[model samples]
Target: MEIKHNPQLTSTELATLWNTYMADSMGRCILTHFKQTVEDQYIAEIIDTALQIAKNHIDTITELFHEEKIPIPQGFGVNDLNNNAPRLFGDLFYLRYIEHMGRTGLTTYALAKAISSRKDIRELYKLWYNQTEKMFDMAIDLALENGTLVKPPYIDYPKEVQFVENDKFLGHFFGKKRSLLAIEITHLGTNIEVCNVGQTILLGFSQVANSNELRQFFYRGAKIGKKQISTFLGILKDNNTSYPSTWDSLITDSLESPFSDKLMLFQANLLSAIAMADYGTAIGGSVRKDIGVIYARLMAELANYAEDGAKYMIKERWLEKPPQTHDRYKLINRKD
Candidate 1:
């Protein structure tokens, strides 16, 4: 008889699974609220789909943790939510939020699948990626049908293939520079949209956060988001390119807290982290020296904001520690 041993999950697999579980749990709570408050039937359908996906993720991760004998993370749950709280966002915001989640979900799942060594882990992420892709497509189609999708600025089609002539094509630091490339325009427009989402969500959080400190933190974050939006919009306008408008109106004036302060703070931190990642990506893709400088500066600001959030969470004991390798120094120093 041949004997085969099942391989254990790697550190990368464990970390990814833990993070996914936490995020999905929080997502479930938020989606549950959206499902209850959303008015449009079509938008409600999307919320229901997303809520189901989040629930399934929580269940699957729990099973995996049980099999591995790993203590399941105490992620967000019903206690963190106030379902009877009045609606804090418009239906359009809910739909747009789902679309943004789908995009980020694709990025996260793709990275997890690529880094996973265990066959089962890779297969799990692959399934999630495919499912999110479908959801992303659904969102785009629905947004178009509803006439709410704002596309990137259009440019005249190139008549013929052309090549960069000299270093002048790479934009300047002080003097007049070359026109923005299509890719540069796309990045600016994308960052604008992302900032709009962040600002709107933070604005809502600020209104309902329980503590004054939490409210201040969210208010500052929303301000940063608004500043970033203005910067991007100014760039697009200077280049004579059209850009998408902010979604500030999507937020309602509801002061009742729908989510716990911990959840709200975590979400604010998450959005800042995502914005930083996106700014870094924009820097990598941009050739314009000025544009790269702008992205770097914005990313630094976000880093500081995120650091403060981390400190606050740590102080409040709201941040859960992830798995870490054993401390070799402590082990060696101990008398046994």
Candidate 2:
């Protein structure tokens, strides 16, 4: 199909492009900083690929916005990064960071494609989806090669096929409970690993944050991350499964600010939103009543934390507004 750019972009198309551009810009800044500090060649290559994609995506989005006569968002840039600063984390952190980010990018881009109607918007999101999948694969391979990837617990194969005959299939709240399914275990392990990665990065952010309030926010995020990680691990232990190891010890004692506070806070907020959404999914996929309740409670906590982070961003005037329709009422009531 010969695709032509529509003179006007739909709201969905506009929002998707605007969000992707802002996110890619922030990602580029962070990856650029990581590029300067990463010592491993394999990890560096992955970051390089991701960084190039982000830069190219930002440029394309900028041109699209300009053609549409829409003002471009002032996203993060080199000024938001300090490449000469001391390394705040070890090489392992960068690898795991990419792993977490790649997962998010795949999810976001797919959803963007689904909601987009314009040919240009659909094609761009599809391209991003494929690109992010490759990036995710690289992250997983590098992590496995480095022995840093968290292995999910193994389960015994069923001796014979069986069908659920009673309510016990859903779960038991009072009596003895059936063992967790492998799928359930996979989601739990993945969420736990994500929290672990977030905690480690937040710990490093807390050390380098310049604003006292932002630093406190990072500390709060770390504390919540620690709690969530333990909660998931406890659930796994209840089923006699081995929990993944922590990566917190990989962070150094460097107090230098390698990233601007705006970049750091935006990242923290972004991860918090992603964590809450994943927890909701884990809850839905879970059969255990107790685990679902746990996810619900944890999501509430994360929602509250994310709200506070947004307020801080607005207070600091650092949050950029996304695209919206013009106010007809305001225009009609305007004073000359």
**Candidate of highest TM-score:** 1
**RMSD, one per candidate, in order:** 1.9, 1.9
- Please give, for residues 187-264, the per-residue lDDT of candidate 2 as tens digits: 888898889878988888998899988888899999999999889888788888876776664788888899999999
Off by over 4 Å in 2: 1-7, 326-336
Q: Per-residue CA lDDT of candidate 1, range 1-336, in tens?
A: 332654788999999999999999999999999988989998888888888888888899999899989999998998899989999999888888899888899999999999997777888999889888887888888999988986777887899999999998888888886888889998898888888888889989999999999899999999999998889998888888777766655777789999999999889888888889889889988999999999999999999999999999999999999989999999999999
Per-candidate Cα lDDT values, in order, are: 0.89, 0.87
Clash pairs detected, candidate 2: none
Give TM-scores for every candidate, taking all chains together and pairing residue i with residue i.
Answer: 0.96, 0.94
In model 2, what is the error at residue 169, expressed in angstroms? 2.3
Candidate 1: stretches off by over 4 Å:
1-5
